[model samples]
Target chain A: MARIDLVDLAHSYDGGNADPSSFALKPTSMTWRQGGAYALLGPSGCGKTTLLNIISGIVKPSRGKVLFDGRDVMALTTQQRNIAQVFQFPVIYDTMTVGENLAFPLKNRGVGRAEIDARVHEIAKLLDLVPQLDRKASRLTADAKQKISLGRGLVRADVAAVLFDEPLTVIDPALKWELRSKLKVLHRALDLTMIYVTHDQTEALTFADTVVVMHEGSVVQTGTPEELFLRPDHTFVGYFIGSPGMNVLPAEVEGRQARIAGHELSLARSYGGLPPGARIEVGIRPEFVSLAAAAPGLLAARIERIDDLGRSRFAHVRVGDLKIAARVPRGLSLGGNEAGLIFEPAHIHVYADQRRVEGAA
Target chain B: MEKIPNQKAWLLVLPVFAIVAFSAVIPLMTVVNYSVQDTFGNNKFFWNGVGWYQELLDPSTELGGRFFASLWRNLAFSGAVLAIQIPLGIIVALAMPREGWGVAFSLVVLALPLLIPWNVVGTIWQIFGRSDIGLMGWGLNRLGFDYNYVANPIDAWLTIIIMDVWHWSSLVALLCYAGLKSIPEAYYQAASIDGASRWAVFTAIQLPKMRHVLVIAILLRFMDSFMIYTEPFVVTGGGPGNSTTFLSIELVKLALGQFDLGKAAAMSIVYMLIIIIVCWVFFTVMTNAGADRKGAGGER
Candidate 1:
């Protein structure tokens, strides 16, 4: 295993650099530390799979250099790179038994019989495929076949890295969690650097040490799960990473003071030298907002709707044509249409042009 | 209390029954009738009982020996065609263009031979194999080989086999192409990631997935080759000491040339029975193989 560095990588399916719309992946650079579980997370058509394919040597980037342990591998084929990848759909040799399927990579590499057998058996045991080792892969259930797909990758010890492209998509819902936990355990036990590509936020957050969130062919943010939740680098990350995402409202900023919907508010940080002509906004998660009984230092608003989520309630309120959501604790006795909505200074974040304003949290 | 059953469902099957009886059963009954009875001049009938069948089945009798010889010939021809065509078809299918306008162009080119009528195919090869003016015959003669299909039995057999291969191999290739197209791209991607060679990919992914289509192609080629008469009859007329006389040609000769209706009818029935039984056996074996693989219940 080795650390992977992507140097100014960009890809265009049409092979043209003039039209940005044709670019599948925008130019960007990042590093994945060795033995670290990193997730490339995004919605569909967000370049996550493109990034994974470029790293796996399946698709050469239009212009970039991929360095594995600082050695450029752009010209190497997938076989030459020796990376193992599991696809969205399980791919196993239908004619081969589970044991043979797991031993395929090693056999291709011309490993000895005894060593291949040992590695196959070890991986089979780890994947809970010991009982079905003698059975043909075509006869197995979808989840079991997926396990074999994973096992084949794990059986080869000389692989540079293991890549997963939505490998759990075909798995049953109840079995998804079980398989995900098993993947986590395998990553830990094998100490292999793995890059998992998925669109599901829960899967990315739960599986990766660092989650790279992409939007519109560009990397929007890359941070730990806690860091992403607490401080999003971009507005897309703030909205994409959380359910009932952070509420953004247009605001005017002057030094340590901000004005929103004709209500003056005190800022926790100053944006003294703001960029000219940049749009200013205030962002706050619903969990940090609270309803109050008409008090100073709070904005007056009309409650539009309340969704009771058993443990907590989401109160969607309107303040001067702007809708803001507030998560209220249970038994708060919120009944009236008119109430005061308070934004916690510590949790409120200021953004200029969709990017987080430095020192303006 | 017993409920009244809906009797209307029976009427829905009436049209199918009528069609089957009219098209198949009636013609088959006429053949069966002819098999058990003898006819003299002006339709004067005599009770033949099992005499014709017994004579045709006994190897000591001339009729029986001819029937068995032609039967063996038919089987060998079918076996050779299947053995050669199936693999050749798969290779052609693999080599066909996969996508874009080239795919359409290749498909049209590949389908050209299959679209030719069987009789026309025979006629084309018949002239094409002439030593004087035909390309293949003149080419072979020029290469210092005395290749005369009309006068030589071995040459006739070779010509017929090659003619049949050219006429039907495209059907098998098209079926295999359809099978290949049905496979998802993920399988190929995974195979590449697994470091599988081209041969391994074919054996593991392409071959296994093409099993159902291959079975269909085998059955079709077997049946067509076994009953083959028109092409070979038009080309060689079962010449050169009856070496190329297959079962259908021999049956036609017995009924039409020699006016042995009873014996021809019996042979026809036997041929039909053999084809049915062999096809049934093939279908059963293939379907059972499919079930056995999936029946192991690897889920648990």
Candidate 2:
């Protein structure tokens, strides 16, 4: 296993002359620890694939070096880098049997026949594919074929890392869960550094120990799933992660309090001398905010709708012209549209220019 | 939903039925009619049931001897053409540029030979093979070879075989190119990441993916070369003492050249049956080979 490092790596499909905003991936440096499960999460065309390709040595970056285990590998081809990639669709050799497909990488590297057989058997057993080892890979279902793809990547013992490019896209929905958990189990058992690229939040959050969220050609945040949910470093992260997302409202902030639609709210920390004329806002998760009957001590809002999501209920409320979502406590009933929103002071984060701003305590 | 058996749906096929009758049935019926009857100068046809067939099948007779010789010649010609064209076509397809303006440029150039009329191709090669004037023939003769297609049977055969390969391999190449194009970019990326060698990728990925197109290429080249007449007829005219005469040329010489309708009709019927049976067998074998892997182990 190797720790992959990107030193100021970036890519522009139009070559280096393109504007910064047009780049497929922006200049950034990060390090992936050895044997860590990392996910590059982003929407389509958000440069997650571009970053993965750079790591796998498939696409050379316009700037910066890629270091593997403290060695510069910028000039290496994908094969020379010795990384394994599982594609979004299963790419099995149609003419080969399952055992042969699993043994392909080993055979390509000129491993001993006995060793190849042993590795293939080990991977097949781990993947529960032993029964179909002799069957033609082309005749299997998509999920089974994807399992073979995974097995091929894992069969090689000396791979630097295994990269997955949304490998479960073609699988049946019911099988995605099984294959996902299987991947987690494989990671723990094999102790391989794996990078999973996907746009699905649940897939990234559940599969990766560290999730890197990218938006519009750059990384917005990189942290643990709980860290991302609890404290988003960028406004985009706060908006992209949570269900119904963290509610963001245009507000005015002073030393110890904030004003949203002319109502004052207390802050746990002090914000002194905020940047002149910055577009300031407040962000808080729905789980940290709740609704109560209109009271003098709370910020007044009109409840627009209530969503009952089996486990909990969330109230979509409007304070003046700004829409906000807050939790509806169990057994709490509202007789009319009027209600008040209670925000947890510690969970309220401030933003200026879409980047999170820390306040002085 | 309840199923309804509609008889009127059969009437909806009337146009197709009429079209097939006019295009295929009526003309084939004429050949069958002539095969069974003997016709004289006054258009007087006498019943001559299977006499022509018996004479044609019996090798002791002139017609049978001629038929067998031309049949063997046709088979050999087809076999050589396929053996040469399929591999050559695949190589050419692989060499083709994958992107940018070069793709369109190469495709158009490759299709030029296929666009030429068969007779034109024959005439071009016929003149192009003349020892005294043509560039190829003069060049070979200068290189100290007596390369005259007119007098030498071997030279005549070589010229026709080379000419056919030049004119038809592009069709196979184009089909293979299309098959290669349909493979996703991900497959190549995955292969590279797996550290596959170039030849291994060709054998394990390219060849298997090109199987369907190769089948088409083989069948087309086989039938087209087996029934070949125009190009070789124009170039050789079945010359050098009938050494290069194929089945089609011989059949045409029998019916139109010597006015032997009954024997020609019998040969034509047999020829049609041969083409049908061969193509049917070929298609079945190809499809079966592809699907055999699924035997009792179909999709989960």
TM-score per candidate for chain A alone: 0.96, 0.98
Measured against the true structure, the TM-scores of the candidates, in listed sequence, are 0.96, 0.97
lDDT of 2 by residue, B1-300 (tens): 999888897788998999999999999999999999999869899999999999888888999999999999999999999999999999999999999999999999999999999999999999999899988888899999999999999999999999999999999999999999988888899899988999988998999999999999999999999999999999999888898999999999999999999999999999989999999999999999887656535332
Instruction: Give the TM-score comparing model 2 with the true structure, all chains together.
Output: 0.97
Worst 10 residues of 1 chain B by lDDT: B291-300
lDDT of each: 0.90, 0.92
**DockQ of all models, two decimals each:** 0.60, 0.60
Model 1: CA > 4 A from native: A294-297, B292-300
- CAPRI-wise, candidate 1 is medium
Model 2: per-residue Cα lDDT at residue A98:
95
- Give the per-residue lDDT of model 1 (tens digit) for A1-361: 8889999999998784658766899998999999999999999999999999998888888988899999999989988888999888788898899899999989988999999988898888888999999988888887888899988878888778999999889888898888888889989998999899999989999999999999999999999998888888888888888877888889998887889999987778877878889999888888888877666668998888888877778988999899999977666775578889877877777889999987644
* lDDT (C-alpha) at residue B295 in model 1: 78
